[model samples]
Target chain A: MKKSFHLFYIFIVSISIVVLPSCTKQKGCTDNTATNYDSEAEEDDGSCTYNAETDVEIHFSSMVGTESLVYNQEYTINGRKVKFTRAQFYVSEIHLHQADGDLVHLEDKYLLVHGEEHAYSIGKVASEHYHGISFSVGLDSAANHSDPSTYAADHALSSLDPNYTHWNWNSGYVFIRLEGYVDTTAAANGDADFGFFYHVGFDEFKRDIDLDISQDLVGSTAEIGLEIDFAKFFLGVDMRTENSTHSMDNMMLAEKIADNADDAISAE
Target chain B: MLTMQFQLSKNINRLTNAGVIPAFVSFFLLLSSCGKDELISDTAYNLEIPKGFPAMDIPLDNQLTVQRVALGKKLFFDNILSRDSSVSCASCHLPEYGFSDPEQFSKGVEGRSGFRQSMTLTNVAYNTLFFWDGGATSLELQLLAPIENPGEMDMNMPELIERLSNNHEYPSLFREAYDREIDPFTITRALAAYERTLISGNSRYDKYMYHEKNDALTESEKRGLEVFNSSRTNCSQCHSGFNFTSFGFENNGLYEYFADSGRARVTTLHSDVGLFKIPTLRNIGVTAPYMHDGSLTTLEQVIEHYQAGGKLHENKSPLITGFQLTTQEKTDLLNFLNSLTDYEFISQTAE
Candidate 1:
């Protein structure tokens, strides 16, 4: 009877040792630097916040070197004059890399850049002292090759409303679209308006750009100026031989345009 | 065994704390005493998710119940839903033919032919669009189309309601399925619920790929899988994923010009003139007379069309760049396509 009682006591102790700690563990923000960090927390509750979120706006300044881009107006590039009709690109995965080695990712940071809707309202980010703001040129690979129609109507990748940036046949997005009439007739700058429609795509052609931009958010919203040189888009490229790429089959040409897209943006 | 005993003891302690064991026993006893005419319990139906299928997004308001699915199945097979009570949903969408018509275009109640071919309903729960033209966004909405169509059942809404209300079984069925009287919302909801249950994932390819059944596929079928997935062929560009369709519209170069504007009529986009929704390749062996217009009669002819590279067809997608296939490769690809036929799904007897 004595031996049996001791065995029962040992079994109860073992069970308590196994399960009691888990039951008693308090959950809260465990990060020490976070505003809501609890010193007594043993489990992370995902309520960690470094500071209050401040709204940030990113505005694009579309230009051709010294000349500002005007729709349907002529611009000289590589001694070839061209009239720009429509120019658009996607910017995504925007982040703020802090000096403290911590990173803050902007939620839903997909920006559709066009002449009309050039500015991107990069939603709220924690108001913390940061070294620089970094963002990518195109959508992340996760969002690539996915059915955009699956998303809600007002979603960034939705195929409804303001028209989709994706292709119907290839089941991929056109990362950048440049359409206009280029001077393809002459040796230098020509008079004839031979049309050019360049639609660049492919996940392999997706580029990332890290801009060393510093901003101090004293107010609720911060406006950051972004500039894209449309002239540099067709550098070291002849428009005469290869004008249109609606198919997105030319990998070599797509790579060139993708490389140029990295240098396309500047912190204005 | 020791842990199981300990768990049982812990559960007993919990039950003792709640003190509801007697109530639970009495509840079951009361349930057992009820007859068939009594109110059926509304326990959420256990929808079986096949190996390759994702969790379905069932609407919160219209939760699936055993009675609802049973009612839907009964309604689907019944001719009373038709105007003249001569045809049912099963007339066009035959189960033996993978829920598709054997004919090029399924005939209506008046024996008049339709424009497009009947699309296979295999794994249709995962579809983004409900129709070839994507006229209806949801399955619930699409159910009304066939019922109201002049060439289809031709039963108007008012007449349908009147007929359903008059039917002795329908009122009780609706009450059991939806806890309400006969209504349009309940009718559509029940139909959609039953249709979503028509899942098929037990194909030889699914067994081989998901269940790791190596012997499920033949050597020719294995080699054919390689050809189908090959970059040279580019078949997987559109006809990809577990469902064998990305559920997107594309102009696959069926003809130089289309007699019937498939998606273009719905969207009113000039560029979308010849485009139609890509049907699932599941049960492809049985579901033919193929394509939107059902122009191609056999799988061999469809393969030949892709092999020829849609050269004559102007609106063909640029991805349809022709590929050279040897006689062996062609046979292998066909074998792979045949491997998608789910025998278990076609022969299913249970609701």
Candidate 2:
């Protein structure tokens, strides 16, 4: 009788093991169209991602009057000898327009273009036929009000240096940086060349540019190169007269730079 | 599902002949059957958010628990968290003062003075940004500053972790709170959980605004509210949100020349010079010596500074242009500000 009881116990345990996992109703992505679709899924999982529909590589290539940006090299514009020692700015809130006029976007990404850093890989986006790219020159109000230290060390928001592009939560980001020494007629403090640092900040100074360039992103990654004309930075205003602007207090200079930021780029 | 439970019980009954005791198996079966899908932290105490307040943004990675909060409260009040065991988070931030220092500058270990005043932690859970200059973004990450600041606790994190690991009760408490060993992530998470619980919403102002209790404030306070909300005064322009601040940095026309760069120290933008975050005024009555550096002594002085305009600076907020105010208006405004104090909240302790 005891031997028969042991045999019954073995049968019961075998059935329990077979039936346990099936009882729990494991739900997962079943649709193959979904980016995270699970093939082995028995039930539909709510977690489905279609991020590939929005990913695209954006490139901002700095230039000076049809000349590719060569840092510290003198470029004569109008009548002033100018050379940018540091050229950096933020490109944020990239939007790609679909044929149906539906907007696909890359949200909360602040891509900083540092002259010294040789433009590292921005991001790998799923290739798709897209209309011209539209992006803001500076961080949006929401992204601007972030605490940098809260982000990872490698994050764009992390303050690399307090003296330059690593802006604070209060002041927002430096929308554009064109700092270099120029041949000045009058040396203010007995200096030969007058150094200029034009820094633009604040939400009021945000510039939006929508370029007209169509690209077929079938399978391979497509690069959206925006050539920023260095000469365009000094279009309306003379660099020799308005030598430096370091604050939003100078609304005139800030507005001038903001206007030039629109025509500063040509998409390809 | 019910049949699965019945089947599980039957299978456990059959396990008796395998030499396992029936009692232990039954207990295990019962525990597993009930709330097996629930998260581990769900078994702990739940957060009680006050009515009419925004939901607390707790990090998904660090959920609040009873053991975690209790452990954090103990750590916050305990001096042993400091370098020499002479100071703590509570040392500068007194409970009576709405978890802030009434002193102009908070003293650290060995009487080393901090550059900025200890801010009030009341309703801190609602803040998206932390500190006067907005250094740390999340509450979990905010603990690193004071613990490592030279003018603060000055406790090295590695040594602090070693000490906690070697402590008589910390290891066991950590294991209960977090099913892991003593580590920095667990430490900061516990502290953040406890800090998130410091909700102060039972004040007379909250009662009036949220509960529709108009009689909670006097006629003077009501008049003061009008003045505060008026565009001419522009007090609500920056301090407009539910928690009494947008938490954005503003120059506020503090000084012509700043010894402390404030936000400019981080952003390195000249436009950010002398800018400091707009602090919540929920418990402004208790948290005296206001502003980033605790420059202003009293509310009267602060209001007067606004009334007399302020020293002109490059990055000063344009809204800060001074307005004329009568003595009665000033008194009434002060009365309104005092109504923000939550009597019950100040008296309550973790115990």
Per lDDT, the best of the predicted structures is 1
Please give the range of 10 consecutive residues that has the lowest summed lDDT in model 2 chain A.
A160-169
Please give the lDDT score at residue A222 for candidate 2: 56
Tens digits of per-residue lDDT, candidate 1, A1-268, equal 7676545545543544354333334678898768888998876979897767678788889998777888898878777878888888877788888778777777666776875566678777676566677777767766765545345545666544253566433445778888898888758546638888878776776788877767675368877777889878787678777777753345567677778986878887
lDDT of 2 by residue, B1-351 (tens): 455556565666655555445535654565566445444543465887777777877877677888888988989988878898889898888888989999999999899998888899998878877888776667866776787677888876557878998899999898888777766677778888889888898889988998999999999998888888888789989887677888799998889999888887655578989999898888889899998889999988889888887889999999999997788888888898888898877775646
Chain A of candidate 1 compared with the true chain A, TM-score: 0.78
DockQ of each: 0.02, 0.04
Maximum-DockQ candidate: 2
Candidate 1 clash pair list: none
> Chain B vs. true chain B: TM-score for each candidate?
0.87, 0.90
In the range A10-71, model 2's lDDT, one tens digit per residue, is: 65555555545444444678866678898877668588776554334566677778677777
**Distance from true position, residue B176, model 1, in Å?**
0.6
Local lDDT at B280 for model 1: 90
Give candidate 2 regions above 4 Å deviation.
Answer: A1-19, A22-268, B1-42
